[model samples]
Target: MTKKNVDDYLQEGMYGTRLPKEAERKHFLGTLRERVILALTIGEVMSDRGLEKLETEMKKHPNSTLLMNGSVAYKFLKQERDLADKYKISHTTISNQEHQTEIGAVLTYDHAIDKEDIYLSNDEDQEKSDSVEKDDQKDQGIVERIKSWFS
Candidate 1:
């Protein structure tokens, strides 16, 4: 390896170590895409869709860490955090003030696993969205019943 130059030292000191795929890392909550097992968007996190799949992934990748976007409210991310605690998986909520990430949560290992796709499939997303819709409908029904009683 070549000797460190003054410029390199200054750069490293000011910005920390230079890493490839910085943009991707920022998007994936300080992890690489290849290292991610599963990733969820803010919408999915709020709706809590495919959480069972997330749990399954967690069980499968025991060493994986759960990285949640700090931008999201803790209330929305609480369930996933609880799951991580239940399974004894290490997890952290990361935030990059300079960039806004749409992803709400990620299941990832320290090293690259190099999986082709990390996001949930359309079928799973659709199924979960459908379930959320049904739940909303049920809550609406109960509200209607209460309203009728009051009237």
Candidate 2:
């Protein structure tokens, strides 16, 4: 390989190597969206709402890195770090002084996997809603039965 010249070194020092999809990387917490396997919101991380989903993704991508937003309180992110440890995945906390993202955590691969969806599935949320509907139906059934007896 040819040695880099003084001018080349100076230019590189003046401006860091260009990264592709920089805006997407900034929004996704230092990783490209396509490389991400899963991303969690700050509220979800704090409440442990997406913990299971995160863990499951970690299990699936054991070689992936877990990148947590350092702006969030460590207590909220510690659980995720522990989960990463369980899966033997390396984890890092990203804190950019110039940019901050609402994303609480990201499970990412080094290379572009171009995953279509990186957010947790809402199946649990869907199940909860279904349960609520069932409860409402049960209440309606009891009321109808009482009305029939009174008639």
Candidate 3:
């Protein structure tokens, strides 16, 4: 049999498998929103206070994900294996264009969503909510408002 082409798979509904459904897309976006604010706050805290401060903060909570530079994480792990092992802290190295040395606790997506106010600053949350409200207002046209009024 001949090899199936892109069009053949598209016709068979095999393509776009990675695309999320409407509800899934909304959930994913909300999760990302929480993670972004958490990460940003953590980064700022870490930068201002250093890794030791971050460690002290993380010690308050169990199973919080910690992000650090690869080299720093390696050295820290080698030097403090006992502490790391005791806390069961997961060490993750993020490599990106931004030059930063970050080490702080992170909440899971679900936890962040449930505790968004705790994770995100008031200003950040207000900004995001305001933008969302604007988009919603834009979505509701005059016709839709009139229909709602009658109903």
User: Could you estimate the TM-score for every candidate?
Assistant: 0.73, 0.73, 0.33
Q: How good is model 1 by TM-score?
A: 0.73
Model 1 spans > 4 angstroms off? 1-10, 123-151
Give the TM-score comparing model 2 with the true structure, all chains together: 0.73
For residues 28-98, write the lDDT of model 2, one tens digit per residue. 88888878888888888889988988888877888899999989999999899889988899999999878
Ten residues in a row with the worst lDDT in model 1?
A: 116-125
> Model 1: per-residue lDDT, tens digit, 18-62?
899999998999998988899999999999985888999988988
Better-scoring candidate (TM-score), 2 or 3 = 2
lDDT against the true structure, each candidate: 0.91, 0.87, 0.45
lDDT of 1 at 56: 91
Residue pairs in clash, model 2? none
RMSD of each: 9.4, 5.3, 15.1
Return the lDDT, model 1, position 129.
96
lDDT of 1 at 60: 92
Give the range of the ten consecutive residues with the poorest summed lDDT in model 2.
Answer: 116-125
For candidate 1, what is the lDDT? Answer: 0.91
Kindly report which residue stretches of model 3 are placed more than 4 angstroms away from their true locations once superposed: 1-37, 41-46, 49-57, 68-86, 96-113, 118-151
